[model samples]
Target chain A: MYIVVAYDVSEDHVRNKVAETLAAYGLQRIQRSVFAGRLPPALVKELAEKLRRVTRGANADVIIIRVDKRALDTAVRIGPALPREGNVHLH
Target chain B: MYIVVAYDVSEDHVRNKVAETLAAYGLQRIQRSVFAGRLPPALVKELAEKLRRVTRGANADVIIIRVDKRALDTAVRIGPALPREGNVHLH
Candidate 1:
């Protein structure tokens, strides 16, 4: 399973900490505020709880999205398709 | 259908233009390089082709992900769950 985590954080310190926490979970930063990678559902649940604590009281909104590869393989690319980071791309 | 569009473009001009094009298609920016919203499958194919054209060159890689709301409703939030734009929530 692929998890795409996106957040809207008001405090810089909390935001950075959230990013680090996501990275610690082995999620790759696909965008500035979006981190994504492959992880099991159980792990995702665990990390979501951790992130919730790390982001507590920062006036932040974080959403974790789960995408099956069937959807990703159908990914329509508009430019030179570079190899994506994990099971994100069909090898 | 919910479509999540993510891109990695090396050029600022192309990136901005691509973002504008996505916005024109009713896709909202959930993150810096990520956009998501409600769009039908046929429209997704159409917009994907357009994005491919707009993002041509500039050493960019763009991906479009489709997610069902059954999955979004399962979204676990750690902070204040602000009403997400479009068909991204259980409401």
Candidate 2:
């Protein structure tokens, strides 16, 4: 299943660290602080746990959202229609 | 512009109340606790502020995400490709 993880991290260092960890697990960056990827249940659980540990005492709030299959399909179809460049058209 | 609002409300009553307020302003429900709609900046700000007030002391956290035009288009295109029925395909 695809997971869309978002975090409101108060510290930039922690955010980068979390992103790096996610990248090691093959997650792709979708936005400034959002990452997306497909993973098995085990991996999802492991990653979530690891993230929580990494943010411990950092005063960061992380939210990992699981996207339903329907939403993932919708995102894929609509993602391409978005402008490929410029902040005005990108989000 | 389109705003995609998501809330993780701990109290069911607060969640429903917030949703009702958003519905009054023309937001359409996209998921169990997520709503999407197009509106002017003034309206979006007003809605967000009002939601904060309604959720005060309710032990709930509300997040109002502003989707770029590109993301909005992506959602629109992919939304149709999603399964029309069943939770398996709907998110």
lDDT of 2 by residue, B1-91 (tens): 5665666666789878988987998987665556667889888778867886888777655545555444443331111223432122112
Chain B TM-score for the candidates in order: 0.78, 0.77
Going through the candidates in order, their DockQ values are: 0.55, 0.05
Give the DockQ of candidate 1: 0.55
- Model 2 TM-score, all chains together: 0.46
In candidate 2, which residue pairs get closer than 3 Å at backbone N, Cα or C atoms, i.e. clash? Answer: A74-B78, A78-B74
iRMS per model, in Å, is 3.2, 14.3
Off by over 4 Å in 1: A8-16, A29-33, A79-81, A84-87, B8-13, B78-81, B84-87
lDDT, model 1, position B31: 57
**What local lDDT score does residue B76 receive in model 1, on the 0 to 100 scale?**
60
TM-score of each: 0.71, 0.46
Worst 10 residues of 1 chain A by lDDT: A82-91
